[model samples]
Target: MTALVIIPTYDEAANLAWIVERVLAAQPQLHVLVADDGSPDGTGAIADALAAADDRVHVLHRVSKQGLGSAYRAGFAWGLERGYDTLLEMDADGSHRPEDLAQILAASATGADLVLGSRWVPGGGVVNWPWHRRLISRGGTLYARLLLGLDVKDATGGFRAFRRETLERLPLDQVASQGYCFQIDMTRRVAAAGMDVVEVPITFVERERGESKMSGAIVREALWRVTVWGAARLVPRRLRKGPRPEPESLASRPGA
Candidate 1:
C-alpha cells in the first residue's frame, strides 16, 4: 500500500530532521510528510531542504501555529487527495520512536482498519518520564477508556496508523480536539464505526528537546468533550448503532 507518515511540528527544529531520516530509513515504502506550523527556528526551511533532497520527503507549511488536530486534518486531506492508501500520525518531538513504525505497519496489514502503537500494552513501555507525567498519562488513558466505553488500553496515544477508507469515513470535520485528545477522539470514532482496531506494543521516549504542547485548557477540553460524547452514547444498547466493547475485556488486556 502507498503509505505516508504525517508529523505535526511547531518549533521542533532540533528533532525534525533526525526523526524524518530515521522514519525514512525504517521502511522503504513509507513516505514522510512534515507539517510545520511556521516554526521560527527554521523548521520549515529544514523541511523544505529535506523535501528537496529526497523524493520521499514532503512538506506542508501552514501560515501559523494551528492546533495539532488542524495540522493533522490538513495533512490527511493532503494525503487523501494524492491517493495514499495508508496514513499514519506521529509527533515530531521524538516521543514516538521511528523504528516502531514497522510493527505498526505490520498490524495494519493484518486487515485492521486502525493500528495503535500503545505504551500500555504488553512489551510496551515509557522511558525518562517523571512519576507525575506517568500518572497523568495512565490516568488520562483510563479516564478516556472508561468514559467512552473503549476497550483499548492506550486510546490517547498519538502513534497510530489508519487505513485510507477509515480516515475518509471518519467525521474529521467534527473533530475539534486540539491536543493529544485528538487521538482519543479519533479512536472513539473508529470504534463507533465498527472498524477493526488493533493495538501493538511501543516504547515511548520522552522528548529530550523542544517544548511540550500540553496545557490545562487542552486537558479540560478533552474531559468536557469525552464526558458529553460518553453521555450521548450511554442512552441504550439498541439506540447506539455499533456494539460497545465489553468493559470486562479490560481484565485480559496486557497492561490494563
Candidate 2:
C-alpha cells in the first residue's frame, strides 16, 4: 500500500535530518512530508535540502506557526491528493521511534482504520522523563478518557496512522486543538465516526535536542475544547446527524 508520513516541525533543526533519514531508511517505499511552520532557525531550508536529495521526500513551508492542527490538515491534503492509502503522523523529535512506523502500517493493513503508537500499553513505557512530566501525561490522558468516554490508552499521543478514507471523513477544518489537545480531538472524531481504532505499544523517549513545544496554553486549550465538544454531543439526534461532505470534494474547496 502507498503510505505517507507527515512530520510537523518548528525550530527542530537538530532533530529534523536524523528523523527523516531514519524513517526513510526503515521504510524505503514510504513518502515523507515535512510540514515546517517557517522556523526562524532555517528548518525550512534544511527540509528543502533533504527533499532535493530524496525523491520520496516533500516539503510544505507554511507562512508562520499556524498551529499543529493546521500543519497536519495541510499535510493530509497533500497526501490525499497523491492518492496515498495510509497517512501517518509523528514528531520530528526523536521521541517517536522511526522503527515503529512499520508496525503501525502493518496494523492499518490488518484492519484498523486508525492506529495509535501508545506509551501506556503493556510493552510501552517512557524513558528519561521526570516524575512531574509523567504525571502530567498520564493524568491528562486519564482525564481525557473519562471526559470523552474513549477507551484509547494514549489519547494524546502524536504518533498515529490513519486510513486515507477515515481522515477524509473527518471534518479537518473544524479540528480546533493545536497542541496535545489536537491529538485527543482527532481521536475523538475518529471514534465518533465509528472507525476501528487500535493502539500499538511503543517506547517514547524524551527529546535530546530542542525544547518541548508543550505549555500551559496547550493544556488549557485541550481542556476547554474537549469540554465544549463533549457538551455539544448531548444535543438532539436530528441536530447532530447532519449530512457530511466527501473528502475529495472538501479538499477542492478554497483554503481546505
- Model 2, CA-based lDDT: 0.91
Candidates in order: C-alpha RMSD to true structure: 11.4, 10.0
Please give, for residues 2-51, the per-residue lDDT of candidate 1 as tens digits.
99999999999999999998888888778989998988999999999999
Q: In candidate 1, residue 214 scores what lDDT? A: 84
Determine which window of 10 residues in candidate 1 has minimal summed lDDT: 237-246
Candidate 1: clashing residue pairs, number = 0
Q: What are the runs in model 2 whose C-alpha is more than 4 Å off?
A: 234-256
**TM-scores, in order shown?**
0.90, 0.90
lDDT, candidate 1, equals 0.90
Clashing pairs in 1: none
lDDT of each: 0.90, 0.91
Give candidate 1 regions above 4 Å deviation: 235-256
Residue by residue across 149-204, what tens digits does model 2's lDDT show?
A: 88988999899999998989998978767888888988988998999999999999
